[model samples]
Target: MQAAEADLEADPRVAEVVAAARAADVRLVRFEYCDVSGVAHAKAIHVDQLAHKMVEGVGLTRAQMALNLLEQVVPIEGMEPVGEIRLVPDPTTFTVLPWSPGSASVLCDQLDHDRTDWGACPRSFLRRVVDRAAAMGITVQATFENEYYLGTEIDGRFEPVDAPTHAPVYSAIGHDHLDGLMLETVDALTAQGIVVEQCINEYGPGQREISVRHTDALGAADQQLKFRDTVRGVASRHGILASFAAKPYPDEIGSGAHIHFSLWGRAGEGGRSLLYDPAVPGGLSPLGRHFIAGVAEHLPALTALTVPSYNSFRRLVPSAWASSTTAWGYDNREAALRIASPFYRREEASYNIEYKVSDPSANPYLSLGALISCGLDGIQRGLEPGEPSRRDPARLSPEERERGKVRDLPSSMAEALDLLEADAVLVDALGPLLSRCYLAVRRSEHAAFAAADVDFEIRHHYYRF
Candidate 1:
């Protein structure tokens, strides 16, 4: 039976999607979203119910947003299951599941029963931040270069699918070793509307990085969710697992979801890169300088969102290639923020900034929202960051660091939460409810990790991704 388009009562795009799903004989649909813990969750329904589900939305427990990475509902004071929220499907995010048979998926925005945005919803908070940037005549474009490990479980131990001695950063032999999985991953991501610019074997054994083309801010975060799903699902199809844990093994390079961003004026006549100017020193426009300074200023508190998990801190050590110091630099990987200049083109379109402190376990929406809000704060206040560092902050002498005003980021999750609480602007941007709940949940994770072994935690996270 054909599902009537108008009967769906959602946006016309949603109606068209439902009609298409019916025509394609899709048996089930997955309403999917990322929870507060950065874990992707879904509620599946038969295709026959798509029409009603689109308008009414599938019911999800309010406690879903209060859970930790282990699916345990964190004992946050205001986030108990005294209520429910609706997962309203976003038609713009609908896509057919390439790996899962006879099933399609769409992302959703969490809402109260009255259809108003939920304060604790990460996706909604991201949208609010995006709108704030819009009101200021600014646009944020971003992309995530995600790195993950491919491994298989054997007799309760996780082992890499392919191992090579020493670091093979972009080794052709390493890429060829997993070329089948990489090609399949590319195809799967392409099918889901995520543009894969390139994929390669990274420095660590069994580690790989995929760089997707950048888009608008919100779409960038949405694509990250899809990218995670695509990589994990495609790997499983090839009889292996893809783990995005910040540190799946001790003594190995951890995976990161490094964010690259560029600021632009709003559409139409305002369209232009605000980060580039030929007249400025280092080609960084004044507005861009302030934005970078803002990010550098608030980076300590922002780490609570970007590197939320306890495992994330393991990846941010002195020589892990993930920056731990609050400094910006020109193409310096050891700095928290790096100014990326395009080698191929000297144009504004190629100018951008890269934030290297974040890991794959972070909620993309929250991470990106915090970043945009801080950059906007910089632009408004005319904050000026000092000269960019030429050397890795970790490798600098104490006198050199003091001279540069460079400081180490929070060393632990507890310390990061402290910084987040102390930062007024970041707290306001996240709103009280979200800030409170996030702190409570993250603290619990931290405490849990302190009470357990690192290997135990690694095992707990490795297969879940």
Candidate 2:
């Protein structure tokens, strides 16, 4: 066994995990990982074998990373079925499945036979980015504000629960309609240690948005995975289908998993907000402006990671509140980035930027990691974000947009992928192997959708995310 694998066996946490499982009567422990397609896959072991498996991890074929949403394995070199990798669990993420009886789960990091981080592991990629930020004496805190739909399947056709009468956006009546499911979901999430901050009925007929408090960059991604699992699991028990698809119904408003982020100084440097400066106009520090500038500069390529699926484009249009241009503004929903208003008397603690273009179809780890990479590059170059738009860039005339340096985001998955391939900063952040495999998988999906129809696109993406 490798030294790191051996060390896992000797760690006291293994025994504690085993004893806790026994006490809780957990019959199986699932070692889970979110794939490049944002789909969660797992291999469960009998409780009796938990300790041994925790150390050695469950073996998986390397080709897993090359698999697209359609389950086709793209032909990426070195990511074939001939090699193997391990799913090494992070014990801190171990949580009993509140929605699934007699089962527990632990998030994992993919490692090679020698126990080194595999380049294609999304979790490991985020770790590398977090380490990079730490080297610069900065820390990132973030959360994914996910909006999803609640529906039921009838005769293989999915229909929203509020199909007959659309609930008004943010209406109390909508909350009453899904009260039981929403409350149980919140309880389940709390049971798993995730702090729920808000729940509301969204603009779509049967859409809902449940948000959680922010955490350290890595934990934020892990929490997002847990949050998705819990919401879906609980909804299933009620015989309801929950979807985080960007556009679940062609005629309805789309759902988004907006990202809220802030940077901070290291604990040694008083751990104050690096993005806050009360004396400055808009309460945004110079560092915050640079970070936003970096994201704007790379917004075209960044969309390939954030709004990844072909279905995502269905929602990212002008005046849709999903953002269509590379513009930042104070509370402007039509801009890709929004500088949120800080709370009264708590500006420093509450200051953060919201990336509006992201969706639930994205692998949280990859999107967050790529975001930090772009922001860091901005800091390194001292880039300025220019003027914040008070009106929608899409509403401005072509001449006005050019004068303001505003650019439109890619309108389709294929276009976004092309931008990503040509971007040196993002490609370098993903590293060679990961960039190659990710592009291969996404390209395969885009090709498949290109050959198919709109119904085919909606069918595949609806429940998968």
Clashing residue pair totals per candidate (backbone < 3 A): 0, 0
Residue pairs that clash (backbone atoms under 3 angstroms), model 2:
none
TM-score of each: 0.96, 0.97
TM-score, prediction 2:
0.97
lDDT of each: 0.86, 0.91
Compare the candidates by TM-score and give the number of the best one.
Answer: 2
What's model 1's overall lDDT?
Answer: 0.86
Candidate 1 structure quality by residue, lDDT tens digits, 436-455: 88888888878888899877
**For model 1, the run of ten residues with the poorest summed lDDT:** 1-10
Name the Cα RMSD for model 1.
Answer: 1.9
